[model samples]
Target: MFELNDLRQTRFYQDVFAEGKQKGRQEGKLETIPQLLALGLSIQQIAQALGLDEQLVKQAAQPKS
Candidate 1:
């Protein structure tokens, strides 16, 4: 039977874990865009600081429509 430790050692599990971490980090960065904007940072500055694309930052800045 597969144990919890065995599952963690599998390639698929590792890949999924890594992907989740990356996605979480990206979401966190995108969520921060508004607060940074409130603090007077430009889209370019936010993109440079967050290591994200200017387009992504701009999209994040857009109103929900």
Candidate 2:
């Protein structure tokens, strides 16, 4: 069972939630990588800047070309 508590009052919960949200946003960005690459972004460039795999970048570029 779970009860709704004021987790926000604790610094630990706040940090954890913030970190989780940041990670979620990062994952969302990764999901959109293909779309971003389709918009004429170079794979090497994307890979270098985003720290993503070049092969993944290439895959993303494929749908556009």
Error of model 2, residue 48, in angstroms: 8.2
Residues 1-65 of candidate 1: C-alpha lDDT, one tens digit per residue: 98999999999999999999999999999999999999999999999999999999999999778
**Model 2 compared with the native: what TM-score?**
0.55
| Cα deviation of 23, candidate 1, in Å | 0.2
What lDDT, from 0 to 1, does candidate 1 have?
0.98
Candidate 1 residue-wise lDDT at 27: 98
lDDT of 2: 0.74
Model 2 error, position 52 (Å): 7.8
TM-score of decoy 1: 0.95
- List per-candidate RMSD values in Å: 0.7, 4.8
Best by lDDT: 1
- Best model number under TM-score: 1
Candidate 1 residue pairs in backbone clash: none
